[model samples]
Target: MDPRSPPPGDGRLTPADLRLWAVLGLALVFLALAALFLAAPALGALIYGVPAPEGIGRTALRAIGARDAALALYLAGLALFSTRRAVAIVLAASLVIPACDLVLILSAGTAAWWQVALHGVSAGVLALTALWLARRNHSA
Candidate 1:
C-alpha cells in the first residue's frame, strides 16, 4: 500500500471529516438547549401546578445550560488538533446523560411526553452525526 494512502481500520479522521462531525455535534447541542427551554416549563406545569416542579424544573434548566456549555467547549475543541478526540468524547458523553434522564422521568410515572419527544429527536440527530463521523473516520 502507498504510504500516503490511509490504511484500513486506522481510526483516523481527516480535518474536513472532523469539521463535519463538529458542526453536527454543535447543532445537536443547540437543538437540545432550544427544546429544553421551550419544553421544560410546559412540562413542569403539566406535572406540578401553577408554581412549577422545582426539582425537575431545576434539572431541566441545568441540562439546558450544560448543553450550551458543552457546545462551546466542543467548538473550541474542534479548532484545536489535540482536542479533536476530546470533542468527540464529550459529544458522545452528552448523549448518555439525557438518556438516563429520560429513563428516570419515565420511571417517575409523570407523563413526560414532551421530554421523551425532545430527547428522541435530539438523540436521533446526535446518533446520525456520530455515525457519520465514525464512518468518515474509518474511511480516512
Candidate 2:
C-alpha cells in the first residue's frame, strides 16, 4: 500500500486522531477564554488574583488575550487542516507558552500557589500531548 494513502477499512478516525480532536477542542475553549479576557480584563485579573490597576492592568490583560487567541487559533488550524506530523511539531512548539506562564506566575511574588500550579500542570499536559502525538505519528 502507498504510505500516503489513508489507513485500511472505513474512514473512521483512530485513537490518535481522537486525541488530536480533543486537543483542538481544548484550543477552542482557550480561544473562548481569551475572548472573555479581552472583553473583561478586570474580571480576568480578579480570577487570577491580580490587582486591576487603572490602565496598565487592563492593557496587559488585553495583550495577553490577544496572544492567547492567536496561539489557540494557530493550534486549532494545525489540528484541523495540517498533517499529523505538522500538528505534532506545532504542539511541541506550543509548549513554550505554558512554560513561560508557569515561570511568570512564579516570578510574580504575589501570585497564588494555585495559579502557579495551574500553569505548571498545563505545561506538563501540553508536553505529554505533544510527545504522544509525535510518537504516534512516527510509528504510523
Candidate 3:
C-alpha cells in the first residue's frame, strides 16, 4: 500500500467526521463570542469595531451574547439529532445575521476595514460550508 493513499477498503475521507468537525468549529466560535460579549462588552465591541456603550448598551451587548449562545446550542442540537442537509439549511438561513452585522458595522462608521472584512468573510465561509454540506446530501 502506498503511504500516501488510504487502505484499499478505506476512502480518502470520512465525511461524517469532517461534518462533525465543521459543526464543532462553527459552534465553538459562537460560544466564544457569546462569552466575550456577555463577560466583556467593551472588548467584544472592539471586535466588531463598535463604540462601547456606557449604560443600557451593556445590556444590549449581553443580549447579543445570549443570542449567540442560543445559536451555538441550536447548532449542537442539529449536529446531534439532524441530518447534514438539515444542518446545511439552518446554516444557510443563518447567513442573514452575519450579513446584517456587516451592514450594522458599516453604518457605524467607526469600524475599520478589517472589522468590516471580518463580517464579510464570516458570511462567505458560512455560505460556502452550507453549500458544501447540502451538496454532500448526507442524510442519516
Candidate 4:
C-alpha cells in the first residue's frame, strides 16, 4: 500500500487531512477562548471576589461552552474523516464567535484593559493560525 494514498478503509488522513486538522485545531483554541470569556464571571467568582452580573453571565457561559464543545467535536470529526472543507467551515465560524465576543467586551466598558488585551491577543492568534492553515492546506 502506498503511504501517499488515503488511509485504508474509512479512517485515513493525508497531508490535506493534517491541514484540515490544523484549521480545526485553531478553531478549538478560539472556541476555548470564547468559552473563557463567557465563563469569565463564573471563573472570577470561583477565583476572585468580583461579582458577576445576573442571569446574563450564566446564560452566556452556557452558550459559549456549549458551542465550544460542539466545535471541538466537529474538529474531532475532521480528524476522523480527514476532510478539509467541512473543518474549514467550522473553523471559520469559530473565528467569528471570538471576534464578536471581543467587540462585545470592548463595548461593554466594564472589563479591564488587560483583559481586553489578553482576549484580543488570543483572538488574533487563533485567526492567524487558521489563516496559516488555510494557506498550507494542500501541504498539510
Best by lDDT: 3
lDDT-best of 1 and 3: 3
Q: lDDT tens string, model 3, 22-124?
A: 8768988999999999999999898877999999989988888998898898877777766666677788999998888988888888998888888888899
lDDT value, residue 86 of candidate 2:
66
Q: lDDT per prediction?
A: 0.55, 0.70, 0.80, 0.57
Tell me the lDDT of candidate 4.
0.57
| C-alpha RMSD for every candidate | 6.4, 4.4, 8.6, 6.5
Which pairs clash inside model 4? 15-140
lDDT of 4 by residue, 10-102 (tens): 233454445545655655764665567455647733321223556765675556566666766767677557644445445566667657766
Clashes counted in candidate 3 amount to: 0
Q: Per-residue lDDT for 1-140 in model 2, tens only?
A: 88876344312224466666767876886798698779998777665546666777689888878987987887777776655556666778878887877666667666787777777777787787777665644342
Return the top candidate by TM-score.
3
TM-score of 4: 0.60
Q: Which structure is stronger by lDDT: 1 or 2?
A: 2
